[model samples]
Target: MESTMNAFPVLETERLILRKVMKTDAASMLTYLSDKDVMEYYGLEPFKTEEEALSEVAWYDEIFTEGTGIRWGITLKGLDKVIGTCGFLNMVKQHSRSQIGYELDKQYWGKGIAREAMEAVLRYGFYEMKLHRIEALIEPPNTASIKLVERNGFMREGLLRDYEFNGKTFDDLYMYSLLRRDYKGELS
Candidate 1:
């Protein structure tokens, strides 16, 4: 039996095992979340300890317990290493839609891990949770993230001026979204 963060359901992809996060993943999770380049546009500060990472994992679990959203830690299949995380945030149940966010270790970025993880989460949202729309907001300077979101079939809706912060300065973000029909090729 698998205990998921959101308890929604677990998903697997060719290169990743999408599962509930455990306190045990703190060390590995810190490797990614603690990086300046990795968290720069994601609007998070670098976590310096397993304790910090573990606390995050605990908070991540609340989305499930509270019945609001779902999130997963991305683990490699063969190595069972936590490389990154992806999930829905600020879910509005009546709207049947939610915001999405994800970040991977800089080491994992170009190897297609981000896309694999994105695909897995999207499936979980649309199929298991019955969400009609899933969206991501990317800070403009993060070109790699922009490409990744595009590769996953999320269309750019528009730019939201000064959408977020990096603890110092505000940054603009481009809004992207994919509807269930868009995911299934029913939308053009």
Candidate 2:
């Protein structure tokens, strides 16, 4: 049986809403995608133009259609602009696992927005999607991201050396994961 009740779901938290990423969200996405500070540890150069952002939206669309992943646009409750994107990647339905990824606007840093968004999605992954395990691949030096996952009950599995080639150089990342049985969050 398929795990998802709705292949695309609009997940909501107290302060944020995670919905599908649309082409119309390009401008909002560029607000962060083009920020070097936000992309510093993202393993890729900051997006240079709206065209690039549009292409990125298209890529996201394709991934959903292919069932490889689903990316959600994170927005504040009363705002129309997307402050970030978060969701599953490298999803393996048969194995009931997937890797989580996300990027938020620098302006929203220091707030608990990322944690709120991640917690909402994690619930969807474990309960709604019936996933056995959800993993995260984070650059070793990104302490904020590491803490974010750790705070949500993901355990550090190990380090993956030279795991990615980020255009200018290679990078190493830490692997973290949370199993459904190990998750302690409210599973609504």
Candidate 3:
């Protein structure tokens, strides 16, 4: 497979930019990671403060250093702050597979920002990273997120019961996947 190790590639859409996540982005990241409403469907609890966001950014850095995952801070064109993040989580190099994930600021909901970012990330994963399959596990009730992946040609695989525990309780997730053969680079 082609080497994506230690590589930080910047991807851009008409209205958004997917760039490497920097420690300096912690303050902007806090805006959404700390918002309960925005994180309701996330498997983990919302970040409690800027320190948490800083730690989260450090975690991201570690994953990148280990070549296990890569995340990009999603920023709107002309905006100085990140509105969200999207990237691979568990990447298996031997299998050419990875699990994709994203979280957006509530204020940017319904603007198709996530969709745009996902498209670029998917393209990078398939064409640039040479990944064979990219998967997403989303909360069952998150219709918006499900639709976003479906629109990108990700096929619904199955439900993973008790797939994740959000501290208080277990939750099910709908698994979705997109294969390299299925991607035609269409982002509409």
Instruction: Report backbone clashes per prediction.
Output: 0, 0, 0
Candidate 3 lowest-lDDT run of ten: 1-10
> lDDT tens digits, residues 58-159, model 1?
888887676666678888898877888888877878788889988888987689888888888887788777788988998877889889888888999999
Q: Runs in model 1 with CA error above 4 Å? A: 1-8, 185-188
* Deviating ranges (above 4 Å) for candidate 3: 186-188
1-188: candidate 2 lDDT, tens digit per residue: 15333557899888998998888999989989999989998877999999999998998887777777888999999997899999988889999999999999999998999999999989888887788999999998899999999999999999999999999788999999999999998959
The model with the greatest lDDT is 2
For candidate 2, the per-residue lDDT at 76 reads 98
Candidate 2, superposed: residue stretches over 4 Å from native: 1-7
How many steric overlaps does candidate 3 have? 0
lDDT minimum window of 10 residues, candidate 2? 1-10
Candidate 3: tens digits of C-alpha lDDT, residues 23-132: 88999999898888888998778888888898989988887877788999999989968889999978999999999999999999998899889989998888778889
Candidate 2 versus truth, CA RMSD in Å, comes to 1.4
The Cα RMSD in angstroms, rounded to one decimal, for candidate 1 relative to the true structure is 3.7
